[model samples]
Target: MKIKQYRTQFIQELSPLYDAYEAESFFYLILEEKHNLRQIDVALNHELIFSESEIWVWNSLLAELKKEVPIQYLMGKTNFYGLDFEVNEDVLIPRPETEELVEWIINENLKAQKFKKLKILDIGTGSGCIAISLAKNIPNARVFALDVSKEALKTAKKNSENNKVDVTFIHQSILEIDDLKNDFDIIVSNPPYVRNLEKKEIKNNVLNYEPHLALFVEDTDALIFYRKIAEIAQKNLTENGQLFFEINQYLGEDMKALLEEMNFKNIELKKDIYGNDRMIFCNVSKTS
Candidate 1:
């Protein structure tokens, strides 16, 4: 059948699960991945058709999409911070809000007049998106990433290599580590801040498919990772070194209070494009 006709049917079948815009986006993404045809190419070539085998492949993918599998996982890759990353069930798919956090780090460090080599650490570095992006953007940065999952580290290591950035990957749980070992000029984490109670707020694509170990915490101790990372940061951060986090929106005040109790100075809570309290920044106090 003509590819355009199939595209219409694809959207119609998926309409019950996904909005038209999202479904159409998925179609183009698959078209580019499987057929190497851009949207413009499809529009221009009215005679283009899918072979029987191609239709079978598309249909199989459609069934999975209806099951609410993330498109990034379906494609086995995603784009973050202008870099392409390999993704799978093992790693949490990088999100746009995390891009903002990376941009903030890059921008702040870029403004410094002293261009010295800086050591950076990314705790809970799923997919190595934040660490790799920092290494790519901040030329003077030596980046290290740590994660608890061996499977997640495997995906993260491949992504660093694919992105052509040299990031040291550590397969250790931050919660259990006594010390970070090296003093870092910047320390950042987007740890498991989503609490168990917040599961109802999550979409099926995330709640069902994304790795829960990287996405959630007990409702009673939602700040467990944050508190642990901050304690380590206090010991490991260089004087005036910065700390950053992508936090759960509902717990902004809780995060602020945690940082304050840790004696973090110059604390700043920032919102994402959606105006959710999604990021926080602070520095280790000189007295601490």
Candidate 2:
């Protein structure tokens, strides 16, 4: 079949689940992943035909897409902060908002006049996207990432190597760590901030396929991970160190209050491109 013919059928089949634009995007994503064909390539070679074996591969992915499996998972890799990251069921897919958070960190550091090397820790690093991105962008940074799941850490380590950046990976839960055993100029986390009650608001694709352990918290105590990580940061952050979080949009006020109660000064809440309150930054005082 000609590529355009298959593209039409592919988008039509998934239109019931995703919008026309999203479906078209998925088509190009799979084309690139499965056939090394970009949208421009397919357009230029409109007669490009899919052999029987290639059709089989595309059909298999189409079936999974109908099942609401994430395209990133289907591709087994994603681009974040201009770096390629290997992803799986063990890790939450890195989002664009998280990339914004990373850009914020890099921009802040770049604005500083000091030439001293800075230390950074990414709590619950998951796929190590943030740590690896920071290390790759900031040549003077020493980056470390921690996760409770050894499986996630394994994927993170591979990503660090694949990205050609050195990031120290620690397989430990942030909830259990009292001190990081070292002070960091920056500590950041995008922990399990979603309350169980918010499950209804989440899409079926994410709710059903993404790992629950990395996505949820008790409804009654939704800020458990944030509070725990903040507590650790209190002791582990160097004087004037910054703490950053990619937060739950609904809990922006709550997050600010928590940081204030913890004596995190200069607390700032920022919105993402979608205008959602999705990231926060705080600084520790030298005396406190």
Candidate 3:
């Protein structure tokens, strides 16, 4: 069968699971990855035909797509912050809101007209997206990333190497770290902020395929990571060091309160492109 016809059948078959646009995009993405055929290539070469094995492989992927596995995981890669990173079930796929978090960190650091070098640590750095993006873009910044799961760290390590960014990947839980080298100019995290009750709010593709360790917090203690990180920020951050978080939209006010109560100065809660409160910024005191 012709590739275009196959793609049309793919969309029709997946229409129950995804919209026409999404299914169409999936068709093209698979075509590109498996056959090196972009949408235009497939369209231009209307006679392009798949071999028996190629057809079998495509059918296998279509079955997985119907199961709602994220396409990034299926392709084992994702583009984020203008860079491509390896992704798998081991790590949560890098997200756009987190890209906004990266933008906030990089742009804020640019505003500092200081003579001192900057150091950054990204807690819960899954896929190394935030840390690698920052390290690649921000010159002369010492970047380190931490994740509790060894499986997640494997993907992050690969991402660091692939992106040619020298990010130190550490296998440790942020909640259990007793001490960290001080004077870090910036600390950022996109930790697990989704509440258990919000499971219904999550898309099927995510809930079914993504790593839960990197997605959920108990509903009663949804801010556990943020609170713990804020406490550590007091001791680990530089004098007036900045802190940033990719936060749960529903808990922005609560995060602000946690930082404020910890005596974090200059606390600012900002919304993402969608006008939902998504990232939080604050600075710790030099002396307290």
Candidate 4:
């Protein structure tokens, strides 16, 4: 069957699960990944057809899509911060909002007049996306990533090698650490911030398919990870060092209060492209 003909059916079938735009995007993404066929190629050549085996592959993927499986999980990999990352059930899929956090860090570092050889740590680094992207983009950065889950660290390690970035991977939980053991110029995290009460707001694809361990926190202690990491940052961050977080959109004020009470200076809450309170940056005071 012509690939174009199958595209129509694919979109229609996924429409019940995703919007028309998202469903259409999934079709093109799979086409490129599976067949090296781009949208223009499909458009320019009306004669392109899927072979019998290729059709079977599409049918299998479609079946999974109908089950509301994430396309990224089905592909076993995803593009993040201009690098390809291996993702699976063990790690949460990288989101665009987190990319904005990365961009924020890179931009801030680049704009500084003195280019210090920086040591950076990423807490709860699931796929090592933040750590690898920083190591790749900033040639002088010594990057380290920490995660509690050994399974997630395995995937993060592979992603670091695949992206040709040198990121030290540590297997430890932030909640258990009394100290980071080294002062860092920057510490960043996109920790699990979703409260159990917010589960109803999550999409079925995410709620059902993504790892809950990487997604949820107790409703009463939504800021548990933030508080613990902040405590460590006070002792471990260098003088004038910066701390950045991809925060729960709903808890920006609470995050500010936490940092302020800890004597973290220059706390700034920045919104993502969609204007949600999705990121925060704070600096350790000189006197502290």
Candidate 5:
């Protein structure tokens, strides 16, 4: 079948579930991923037809799309902060808002003079996206990432190798670390911030497919990770060390308050591109 004809069928099949344009775009993305053929390539090389086996493979992918499986998961990779990462059901898809979080950290900490080496820790580093991007962008930073799941860390370790950046991947829950590393100049996390009560607001595609361990917190204890992290940050972060988070948009004030109470000084909350209060920043106290 021609590229155009296959796309038409793909769209027709998916239109009931998704919009026409999204279905068409997803069709093209799948082609690019599976066949290494872009939209223009498909147009110019109409004679470049799929072999019988290739058609079978394409048909299988089409069936998965019909189930609303994420294309990133289907391809087993995603681009985050301009780097390709291996992703699966084991890890969360890195979002653009998380890119904003990376930007905030890079822009906030970049210093020109000595090319100072900074030690940074990323807690709940699902895909190692935060730690890897920081290590890549901040030349002198030594980075470490911790994830509760060994399987997710395996993916993150592969991403670190694929990206040619050095990040120490640790398999441990943040809540389990008792002694402070006490070496990091900065600490950051994009932890579980979604309250379970807000699950109704979640779209079906994400709610059904993405990893829930990376997404949800009990409504009554919405600040559980933040509070625990802040407590640990007090002991681990360098004096005047900066702490950053891509936050639950609804809990900005609460997050700030929690940090301040935990003795994180100079706390500030920032909004994402959508104008939602979705990021929080603070610094370690210099004195009692």
Candidate 6:
């Protein structure tokens, strides 16, 4: 069958679930991945055809897409912060807001007069996106990533290696530990901040397919991970060390208050490109 004809059919079928633009984007992504054909190639070559076997494979993928499986899971990979990462059901797919968090950390540290040999830790580092991005961008940083689930850690370890960054992966839960065992110059986390009551706000593709353990908190204790990690940071962060978090958008003021009560100085709650309060930064002041 002519590939362009299949493309039209693909988009039409998916338009109900996703917009025309998104469905078209998905078609081209699959084309590039499966056939090594770029969008330009497909546009220029109207006669291009999908072999029978290839059609079968694409049909199967289309079925899964109809079921609302994420395309990243279907492709078994994704791009984040200009690097490739292997993603699966074991880890949550990296998001653009988290990339903003990484950029903030990189920019803040890069402003130093000279790059210091800095120790950094990423708590609940599913897929190791933030840690690896920081290590890749900040050459002098020694990065460590910790996650509770063994499966998630396994994926994160592979991602660090694939990105060719030396991020030490720790298979431990942030909630279970009292101390990080080593003082770090920077500590960052994009931990579970979604409350159970907020589940209705989540799309079916995420609520049904993504790892729940990495996404949810009790409605009564929405800041559970943040609180636990902040406590550990109080003890394990070096004097004047910085901490960063990708927070739930609705709880920015609550996050600011939490850090203030914990004596974190220079608290800065910033918005993402969408202008939602999505990230926060603070530094521990030993003297305070």
Q: Per-candidate TM vs. native?
A: 0.98, 0.98, 0.96, 0.97, 0.95, 0.98
Residue-wise C-alpha lDDT for candidate 4, range 151-185, written one tens digit per residue: 99999999999988889999998999999879998
Top model number, lDDT:
1
* Weakest 10 consecutive residues of candidate 3 by summed lDDT: 109-118
- For model 6, how does the per-residue alpha-carbon lDDT over 1-288 read when each residue is reduced to its tens digit? 999999999999998899999999999999899889999998888999999999999999999999999999999999999999999999999999899999999999986627478899999999999999999998778899999999989998998888888998899888899987799999999999999999999998899899999999999989999999999999999999999999999999999999999999999999999999999999998888
Candidate 3 TM-score versus the reference: 0.96
User: Candidate 5 on 54-160: residue-level lDDT in tens?
Assistant: 77887888788788788889989999999999999989999999999999999988863156789999999998999999999998788999999999999999999
Q: What tens digits encode model 3's per-residue C-alpha lDDT throughout 95-187? A: 888899999898888756255668999999989999999999888889999999998888899888898989888898888976786558899
User: All candidates' lDDT scores?
Assistant: 0.94, 0.93, 0.89, 0.93, 0.87, 0.93
Per-residue lDDT tens digits for candidate 1, residues 142-251, read 99999999999999999999988899999898879989778999999999988888899999999999999999999888999999999999999999999999999999
Colliding residue pairs in candidate 6: none
Local error of candidate 1 at residue 29 (angstroms): 0.5
Query: Residue 194 in candidate 1 has what lDDT?
Result: 89
In every candidate, how many clashes are there? 0, 0, 0, 0, 0, 0
Residue-level lDDT tens digits of model 2 in 1-288: 999999999999999999999999999988888778899998888899999998999999999999999999999999999999999999999999999999999999975626788999999999999999999998778899999999999999999999998999998988878887899999989999898889999999999898899999999999999999889888989988999999999999999999998888999999999999999999988686
Model 4 clash number: 0
lDDT of 4 at 41: 99
Report lDDT (Cα) of residue 90, candidate 2: 95
Model 4 weakest lDDT span, ten residues long: 108-117
Against the true structure, candidate 1 reaches a TM-score of 0.98
Better of 1 and 2 by lDDT: 1
